[model samples]
Target chain A: MPATQEINIQKLGLIAGGGNLPAYLLSICKDKGIEPFIVGFDGQTDSELMDGHCHQWAEFGAVGKIISFFKSNDVTDLVMIGGVKRPPLTQIKPDLKAVKILSRLGLRALGDNDLLSVLKEELEGEGFTLHGIQDFCDRLLVQEGALGRFQPEADDWIDIELGLKVSQEIGSLDIGQSVIVQNGMIVGVEAVEGTDALIDRCSALQQNGRGGILIKTRKPQQDKALDMPTIGVQTIVNAHKAGLAGIVLHANNVIVADIKTVAKYADKYKLFVIGAPIDKKSKSVTERTPKA
Target chain B: MPATQEINIQKLGLIAGGGNLPAYLLSICKDKGIEPFIVGFDGQTDSELMDGHCHQWAEFGAVGKIISFFKSNDVTDLVMIGGVKRPPLTQIKPDLKAVKILSRLGLRALGDNDLLSVLKEELEGEGFTLHGIQDFCDRLLVQEGALGRFQPEADDWIDIELGLKVSQEIGSLDIGQSVIVQNGMIVGVEAVEGTDALIDRCSALQQNGRGGILIKTRKPQQDKALDMPTIGVQTIVNAHKAGLAGIVLHANNVIVADIKTVAKYADKYKLFVIGAPIDKKSKSVTERTPKA
Candidate 1:
């Protein structure tokens, strides 16, 4: 057998969301002979990502500590992986420095997007380069064409097109990803409750019929490094229960955590899975603009 | 004392959403000496509405029967009241006639709007006139002006303007009525979750010291009689908990379920309550263009 190619790998900073992506990314980094330092938010960062891959760590509400850890360890670049629950307020205990920064942000600035933006700016100001997770984890990026059994009928494509466009606009608002569309109409959109609950809501709307399509994608003006969109086999399972016809994600921008498993499940459900690249010209205005 | 002009009320119908609106409308209907008939949804109609005010009624699963209930009771006109939860599927024991209607609607026809739109068409097809909840209870309509001690500042008005326009656009989609905004940014939106849950989610988003605002209004194309927006004292209480600045509802289209009690709570929280009449000129697309 031919020897595996050896490549130069640089150290990486990992801001993990609660999922297997971080662990998988770390394993890839290790195989590439790269070191990864981890920082996680409470209730969001998967603990499994810390399985002998990280060099430094810190918790949520300890933004300053995270910065300090990254600095002390000399980690200058990072990747934010997967998705997370909206921060739980019950367990948060902000340190002094974190409190001062937080206090200056007016009530409106305290929203999740604004808060995350603030953190991003602070880290950037400190001389660390934050690259989109997809920048390094090329293996996790989505590919084009149908990976599942169902390639979608003509009608399903119409709804899929509509759902994909609407979800991206919703993302631009920083509301959430994952919208349920059926017969060219959006039935439900995921907000604070996330995708699972949104699917449940969509299922309730359908009496017993199945024609809806589930769409997930990147935000229009998305900051990818801080929020890498993701999907899994479970998403396929949820789509099946909701009577969904197809599933769509942004090619390259979206992460498929366990592509093999997800692909198999999609095959079993006859659900189409496609990684659609953003058309540069159409990025400004989505194709399926909702009727006014 | 000027003799109070008693409403020479006839052909009046009371539309109510859950909570206290139905009972309140019923009492008002009784005082006026009108035998108020109701067209209420099952699982949503207060048991009280069925027992006291309605001379004719039928559950949602039986729209075919409802048309006859109104006509047989000599109810020449009708109104819709009280919001219904999405009907639970497990309880869908549709009568044969309802099954016929259900067959007419495809998978895309989900939620109350789709079903109600079809019902309205079918009812008109049968010569029954549908009406809004505020038709008889004119006193429940919000007056144009600030209704409490607190008044909106410049920034609050800016947000109000932004929200008002966005809410209308969202309304056109038939997506929802309430939107949570902060510092000219939308934080959370009401999509099937209703008002209270919208506020709860917006509150959870408070991370940088930014509280938010909640805006509720009627959809531009919404048939006035079937659904006029509403809020009450409890709305103010929820606003206070959610760390909101004010509440904005359409001056004419919305009902403050209890004005005096709601005003009292607004005073306590120093929450501004603005009731702007739907812009009279904004009926067409040109006028509907959102103000800069």
Candidate 2:
């Protein structure tokens, strides 16, 4: 449904990935007045998003086609959302462009962060501006303070302190960015399995006991646009299952889906929620400005 | 099959609890020298070690008897090895003396390090010198180098950097003592489940096309005799299973079990066994003497 007005939308780009995030963004944009162009990834970056948003789409291999589409359509302000979910290197058969990216990254002595940064640099050098998910929605960003009635105790603060230090250090290494710390000892840290498993195992470690704290953050310099750390309803559910005492968001920098429902869920579970104050000693994966 | 010259082995005191560690320690001590006095933890400490190490052992509630046993006997040096696995708060039927000691540790603390440190202090206050596992075996103190023919690669050095930084920060929280980094990204960090599980998971992550490297160290001010970092044949085996490229241990400070076999296994798997050179950055957890 292209907008049929003097301002009829015909020029936009949607760098899509395997998530509802891009689809939602593109749908909203199309509904308003713009037709979204698409740049998709293989094995990731949802295919259905192509139906919703692509004036021209790539099979992750067709980078040249994606660039040509955007250039021909006079699309500017490229918004890359979601991610290609780190492909299975052994099975990947990249197209020439992706092959170039991969071989360059592999050969340039680049680690994960180095590769990511250089990729961002290379893309920008090709006239694409980097835009984070925050550019779309304001409510997605977590706010300050306990979102619900459950208040944190001093002990929770201690665990938060301990969890933050551990999480940040791990995050800086490009590992998963989350840790379950109970009474200043980490019960679990996320490996490749992700956060839910970490929380699940922590419950077992706690022996169904109460008082565990879950801290989730982002990896350092992990291109906020590429991988904005997110927590959602499943997080609250996991916290309840894990007997976690509270949830601490990195003030305003992190993303949480649906605040009201999450707050209600926390209340239902009697889980304490605190918007951790960011100061010199404390920093989340995204270091939000210190709360006034 | 007791020692030929048994000197007052009648008053055995086994600080028994949890896993094969204390059990093995007890068996060797009893088989070689005198019997031991026992101390059992209901939930965390394994009680079965008592059967092998102690002449007579009771359940967890026998704190009074344990104190009395130490008092009655001329036992001086106390060994605190193997972790409690879990602190059995539900089984706390403390004697007056034990109750007094418990009162000193207020709430807001459940970390293993804090608990162990407090226990050590209380025992020392009562004129008991807390000893480590090293008191039993001189050879267990591993030397700084590859135990096998395999040497670490340049990439392994990068992983070591990431691993050391992350592990030290985790240690600073007194949360965990190990982190697995591969290709300058963390694959796992040891929380409650010890290093073996960490090794296996990181390896699996790599087998799924993610690389794996492991780092293990101790918290600063940690009583080395208690849970001094150890690696054994099982560690090498796990590393091999996980497809780990290398392991970076703190030089000279770590323990590698069965050096000859460990080296052979490492060589078989083409694994790199390295003792990471100590630098100022690695002292995040505790103080270290710069060696020649």
Best by DockQ: 2
Instruction: List, residue by residue over A1-292, the lDDT tens digit for candidate 1.
Output: 1222333448888877777777777778877778888877755676666766654445667877888888888888866666654443445677766676668774544446666677777789889877765665556667765666667665556666666666776776667777887644567777556777777667765434555777788777667667767788788898888777778787666778788899899988878888765566655223432221
Compute each candidate's TM-score over C-alphas. Answer: 0.70, 0.81
TM-score of 1: 0.70
Task: Output the lDDT of residue A257, model 1.
Answer: 77
Chain A TM-scores in order: 0.84, 0.82
Docking class of 2: acceptable
Task: Please tell me the TM-score of chain A for candidate 1.
Answer: 0.84
- DockQ metric for all predictions: 0.15, 0.45
lDDT of 2: 0.66
Instruction: Tell me the lDDT of model 1 at B64.
Output: 57
Candidate 2 residue lDDT tens string, B1-292: 1222223333334465555566656665766675577666656576555554433454544555666677777776677655556554554566776667667666533667776676667667877776666556555556566667776654456556667777776776676778887555566778888888777666556635435778887666567756777787788888887777767787655766666777888888888776764556555323333221
